[model samples]
Target: MDSHNTLSARAVPMDTSNVQIPIITVWVVMTALAAVTVCLRFYTRHSVIHILGVEDWLILIAMVFSAGACVGSIRQTFFGLGRHIWTLSPEIMVQNGIEQFYNFLFHTMSLSFTKLSIIFLYLRIMSHGVQRIATYVLLSIVMACNVWVLIYQFIQCIPLKALWDPSVPGTCFPLAANIAAAVLHIVTDFIIFLFPIPTLLTLRIPKKQKIGLVLVFSLSFFVCLISIIRMVVLKNLDLTDVTYSLAASSYWSAVEINLAVICACLTTLKPLLARLFPKLLGTSMASGESSRPNPLPRKLQLEAPSSRGRPSRRECWRLVQVCVLPPRVR
Candidate 1:
């Protein structure tokens, strides 16, 4: 009778209804956004601009990894994710373990590539000086940190198989390692979000254009917010209630990565928008007109005027400086 009581006490009631619906929904929405943004970026870079550069390629690769991460999340949902761990069958649990390992890999790769994409975009657009040097330094740091995290992720559990098979006798890294990683990610995201601000403010563009660019670049602040939320979720991660606790992290990770991809693509869409809806973007310059000389320089074209009408030397120097500076993007 005592034994029967013990067995009954250990048993958990099953929840037959689907608890993973929300996870699936989030994944579906994220994947769709990533797809749409990637398509638009490709069209703008290759067909519209006729200049496909390194940043475009990096973003494309990041999108691929983002898709992989989305697929992993969807697979996790089918294996008792979003439900109580006690309700999972042994087979589902095993599958979940395997899927979780791959999910981390997908997440790390996606995030690394996204950062690289942003860095490459900065390198391409920024003038060669302290800003460019700073970008290169950040790129190196991001690459090293991401690679270390990826390597650590795969080797965190000894015997390798111990990652998926709890029966194996092997050591695993402490959960603190994961928390530390989350903190690092959030820190780097904050840095990346703020890195371009000083240079952006120094541009010679009109005030309206400057404000618009600032707002556009400031979209990374949302990504930083998402990273902070992910870090909070990681801090409260419950090993015993992993399936439930991990749902928050999974959702935030999906949103963060896909949103990063979307943000990276947003800046590249200006040319396309300028072509399709010039009035909306407040620019009539077609994508192909990027190479043409600006009419502003011609207006400043002042050959040596008659002695009486000649401008002051200071005014002539100012005009020369304006002519030497690169044309602003409309």
Candidate 2:
């Protein structure tokens, strides 16, 4: 049954079709969308908020890697990515493999940095408490996993050139290693998706604003779903007709990475969106308080109670503002 399944996958109608156009279309469109969102995010951070956090810089790095991945995918199409392996010349096959190697590196870097950017955003919002500690733990795990993957990416095959040049006399790890990495990625996606919910729920914001914030962060759930779908495609991949069978996996992989970038940028775009659609995001441009969308300063977050044994009304209000308002709104 296993052999039959693999054989059937290779024989599917899509495998015989030239998917180069569709693949290129998906990558190009997604890259453009991600690029625009990233630009707007920077505009909001610099012009509207007048503050740029570490998360912003990290996301910019992620976008750079995402662009690299997009370039790799487009290049692969020209090297026979959407055709059967048997039909490709050995030279073309080697070229495609080289592109694939770089694509894997770029995609992995994009995902790691994108995740780190979101986690840092969480850190900025969360007060020093158990929740903050949890965020740190998640950050550490993500960093460790990504570092492991990066190391494996370069050394999985002995004599590095063996990865693309099959004629090289060196061994490579079995396909199971790649599968394990994919599964780990999906697991982290789930964790990151759920990490902020408890903090959001405990916020003292208005129900409407709370819901809007939740919806904004939850947008990454769609990226999680795309990751799972891409993992499924990879799990059943048939190596005999690798070039053809891998097309769907590559398409979905590009979608997953680019869509993640789009979602990450969207979270920081609340200021821009609020300026345009004041009624929707609960910001009124007419009001000075809502017009200046800057984050509370570090000193404000560390302020202490007055000599009266409790925080003053002014300090309490500032705390409330910190918690109830979005970073871009504070």
Candidate 3:
């Protein structure tokens, strides 16, 4: 009876000041940015370019997952995510655990679809050769890693009920699995960031345009930097104060996922931007050479002609142009 009274006395709530606002702010802002960017991309592809492809569809799926993650984050905040675990009521603890499971699920799905969307974009633009083979290999790795992680997340605790209700018996995988997964995520981002550099360098476009393309793709490096920072933050995570430690990591995760979606959409916005602000994009609709319509899909073959006839430099330029530029309405 004395021990029971002592335990009851120790159950006092910890001070949980200012923990919820930052999470809510980050989720709202990042999700809004992702939504706006995705909507613009859809408009560009469907209404402006009129050539919606696999990448577009994949990105849309990613957006759905991202939205789910945002919802999970919001729900987590309401469940006292920023407070000390000891401060949370029993019901809040159960709710937070459930939210975390869905949070991981949504994040895994969002990232997988986002990477696949980018790979499909590359496959569509790159010619069949070593580059294409490398892309295929990367795709296989991404699919494998994400699927494995997703499966492991659910099964980490045997007697799955223990995930939300710790009163039940269960065991979980080591934390090292999470670190390893994070490393793979960062490495893949690095590879994707570097993949397009060589091809962009060899393009026959104007030097300015080449530089612009390179800079645009280099934005992925920032995403990689964010990933590295997240890993570092995770390394320092304090399990004793999980809610506090998780605040920084959660903010970074939100920023990383939303930024990835934004970058994916940015590449597709050139045509719409050129149309809306021609001078800003250095495009003039009246200039015959500068504003030529995109080559017809049927005429834009991915492979070079057979050895029978070697194509001239001008012919090669046209092929590259067709691959890189958004299709214009004739």
**Which digits, one per residue and each the tens of the lDDT, describe model 3 over residues 216-319?**
88888898999899889988889887766788888988898889988877777776776676555653223346654333233322335556564433343333
> In each prediction, how many residue pairs overlap at the backbone (N, C-alpha, C within less than 3 A)?
0, 0, 0
Winner of 1 and 3 under lDDT: 3
Q: Candidate 2: TM-score?
A: 0.83
Report the CA-based lDDT of candidate 2 relative to the real structure: 0.79
lDDT of 3: 0.76
What is each predicted model's overall lDDT from 0 to 1? 0.75, 0.79, 0.76
Best by lDDT: 2
TM-score of 1: 0.82
lDDT tens digits by residue: candidate 1, 1-330:
999988886795555455578888897899789889989988876675455668778888888888888888888988877888877887888888899889888888888888898888777656647777899999999988898888888888898778778888999988888888877777888888898888778856556656877898899999999988998888888889788778888889889989988988887776566557655554312344453333322133333545666644333432222222223311
lDDT of 3 at 73: 91
Please say which candidate is ahead in lDDT: 2 or 3: 2
Error of 3 at 323 (Å): 9.1
Give residue 273's error in model 2 in angstroms. Answer: 1.6
TM-scores for candidates 1 onward, in order: 0.82, 0.83, 0.83
